[model samples]
Target: MNKTDRLLAIVLELQRKGVLRAEDMAAKFETSTRTIYRDIQALSEAGVPIVGAPGLGYSLMEGYFLPPVSFTAGEAVALMIGTDFVEHKFDSDYRTKAQSAREKIEAILPESVSQETNRVRTTIRLLVTGETYNSGREKEGLEALRRAILDKRKVRFHYSKNIPGADGNRHSVRDVAPYGLVFAQGSWILVAYCDLRQELRHFRLSRMSDLTLLEDSFTFPTDFNLQDHKPADDRRVLVRVQVHPDIADKVKGAGSFFMTQMEDHEEGLMATFHVRQPEELLHWVLGWGADVVVLEPESLRNRVREEAAKMLKGY
Candidate 1:
């Protein structure tokens, strides 16, 4: 980067991290400590509120803040693409907010950069499937749920419960202390302490109705860590599958979420995934049809064989 860009980046880094060591900055910028020092000196000369101590490294002076910085063409394009993804994948309220944010960003950018960003926005497309869009009531409920979670308040909602051999869905009003929200598999799930069940439960946001934010406040448990929490069936089982070469790239791209490891093989790509349930893994493998073959876990293989036979019978 040029000296100007480096100085701006240094300000941004300090603003983000509060303090940073000269050695670390040097390594991050791929430059010598002397160069970093020179850049720091240049920024100081420009009246930037930078302070340094012998052991504490460098920091901006207290209460120092920089004005909004301009984005390069590349940065603008990236932001535009992100907004596009949000618009396509998120709920209507979120999509509307994203569109407003994009407009505000565009208004701040230089004409040339703005035009390029608009071009990129028009060209890029992010498509997703298996998503159920929220109705107006559900959108309002989601907003209320987020507020309840943030405020450490309790919430009440009528949840639809699916029971085996039931005539229809059973509806029950549940009082829950909101904890966290999770977006997974194209659905929003609320993780909360259900007063009705007397335990933590995952409630599908879509299956909830008559949502109401309670005035009763709750104390958030200091010991409760969302990252440490796991379901009863959290034991991971390794599932191996072979994939066709044509779809290998797609399979590998999804490895972060599933298919934890993959390698090339003579037949195709050998992929390994860690899943809590064999049926969950089976469903994913079956989605690829003949392009994928389960290689391990005799139970999963047998299940796939039975499903395939049923499919063939339908044909």
Candidate 2:
């Protein structure tokens, strides 16, 4: 970067990180420490308030704020698209904020830049299924969970599992300490500390019913960081299926989370899936009817056969 841009970037960095050492700034800007010193001197000469201590690094003076910076046409487009995504995916509160942010961004851009950004953004679109209503149940659940997480409070809900238990029960009540919310695979997932299980658990908001925020509060763990949290992977069973050539593209495009690999074959496409259990794929496999044939895991094939028989009997 040129000296002018690098000097402006240094000011923004100080505003963002509060304090940064000369060595760190030099490394970040890919320049020498001597160059950083000269840049700092140049900024001071330009009347930018930079306070440097012997032991502590350089910091912007308290109450000093950088004026607004101009955005490139590409940057403006990216930010506008982000706002569009937020408005479509988030709840009512965030949707309004996103719209306001978009307006502010557009207002600051030059007319030429704004036109270019608009032209580029028209080619891109965000299509979110099952989020038609702003006040849908899932969005409502997200709003409630967001509040509970911020307040460090407990939440109660009835969750419906995908599979029924031995007693044919598929629903259960849970009391949990809300930690964070994650959006994955077109669904909102809640990460919380389950009071009953005495451990962290993940719950899909779509499967959650009768969610209630409790008055009880809990201390947020200091060590728990949502950015670094990785959910355990438990998919162990491997099931392979052969797809007829006609529907091979459709099968490949299904984007099943359990699907691992797809190999071209003379007969058709061999699609491999890794799941927690064979039953987890039973319905999905049967959905393809005659087009898909289970190649392994006799249990899934048998289950599919039984289900097909049941369908035939109904017919």
Candidate 3:
């Protein structure tokens, strides 16, 4: 192997096994002992902290690991380009952490790797979100919710829910213990237990105000599974929907959106889906416009007709 290849291999060997005898490396690389000694000298001159003793062979200094040296120019461009893209779309508060991680990655990389990284950083570009990003408020709530979820601990936060037909008197405010945070439709939602309802519930983090983390903690029962915590089967009503033939490929796939077996129909393709609430799916069906037909479960058909009539009245 050439000098650069030999040096990189030696560093890798030291890292893998924690130590290597010069004689052993020389034999592995098919180089003479004298040449290996010269390579070691060159490596030390280049700031590599290689530790060794006459009888013990050679080992890298503790904590001073070397990175691979054979990275190509094209590869570096790819990394910097990708990192730049990620740097923007990532949450604002997490951006700094991402940058720090980038620095560590650049540090461990060999010159070719580092150079390629820089080339991409300098040559490639990314579109920033334009809008000011402040993850401060969102970050704290998420952090608290994350910790609670991972450790199976609980956190308390104040929240509000709007009451129907009550105008200003409709606002209800209270505290809850957060159990899990879920990402849906580009928003963050906290699933928690309502001390009032005595059941698990989901709340939009963005909608919550005066959020504060509580010191008190609660344990999730070994029986409590997050996957099974959605509104219970009682609230999940089965409604059949007919998907138009043209839209079948688009709508009839696996998801909470539609139930299985999207069969072809005279009017359209028909299937069933479980919905806990009406408003969300109502909009979804409308988004498909006239292409989808809401079938069976008279409640759903009535709901669609009622909503449609309301839309016409509004217009």
Candidate 4:
């Protein structure tokens, strides 16, 4: 392992054990006693509190404490579920990080609850096989962009919109100051300033190519609201529909279409969504077998009727 990896591992290991011997640490790291002492010295200089005697070995200074952190049941479940879900993200390296995180959690958590959690999670597998995940460049760009946002710094990147041309080819490249990265429908979106549009635009991360971070910085608009920029459905097309009483329970929770696939909803559930287009919603409504029907906004019903008639002729 490199210096950073070794350093982080040492801290985690120390955190695992209240105390450790310098000789044992050197043996564990396959390094000499002097090197281990030097490493300990570097860690102390770098903010880790190490205190002890030579014969008694060393210990992270007693009484030193990290901020107390608490997790609610809801939060814990959410984390496990989120991590399980993220396992499918394309060619993602976060799986290793996820494993390390789970280990850390299991290490600190009450044995009984943690064991039960692991029992179920072990049987669950999320595979993103045959999927082209976010390219490494996109991931790096996103990481950099996120760090910049946290630091309130600005970044410049070479961005290009995958806009189709009259001949179905990609349009010219564009420049962007990435603002945020969002995942929708298992696809990532990079929300940024499109210099070509001279305004805000969202680009599909999977389609973005040639990303570069510029040293330029920006201040978010004082009145800026990230939530408002992309509602639960940004390209949402709302349409009223009549669903059967049998499926009414499904409507009780209008799971976010952009965030989730409405896993709890029953079949034939009629719901309104701001999708890319009206036809897409119509197709969904029709797929609910016969229990679903269009109730309001005559325009949508008429379009469905037209499509149905056309389909009937074919049948």
Q: Which structure among the candidates has the greatest TM-score?
A: 2
Per-residue lDDT tens digits of candidate 2, residues 207-286? Answer: 88899989999987899999999999999989999999999999888868889999999999999999888888877887
Q: Where does candidate 3 stray beyond 4 Å?
A: 1-93, 110-140, 143-171, 215-235, 249-261, 265-267, 277-280
TM-scores, all models, native as reference: 0.67, 0.93, 0.53, 0.48
Q: Name the top lDDT candidate.
A: 2
For candidate 1, give the lDDT of residue 254: 68
Model 2 residue runs over 4 Å out of place are 132-135, 164-169
User: What digit string (tens of lDDT, one per residue) describes model 4 on residues 170-268?
Assistant: 545766666677876656776777677898887776565555566666767776676667633455556666667676665545444522232223444
lDDT (Cα, tens digit) per residue for candidate 3, span 166-253: 3442334545666666665545677787777887787866556666556666776677666766554544667777777787778755
State candidate 4's TM-score: 0.48
The C-alpha RMSD in Å for every predicted model, in order, reads 5.3, 2.1, 9.5, 13.3
TM-score: model 1 vs. ground truth: 0.67
Please report, as a residue range, the 10-residue window in candidate 4 with the lowest summed lDDT.
258-267
Clashes of each: 0, 0, 2, 7
lDDT of 4 at 67: 46
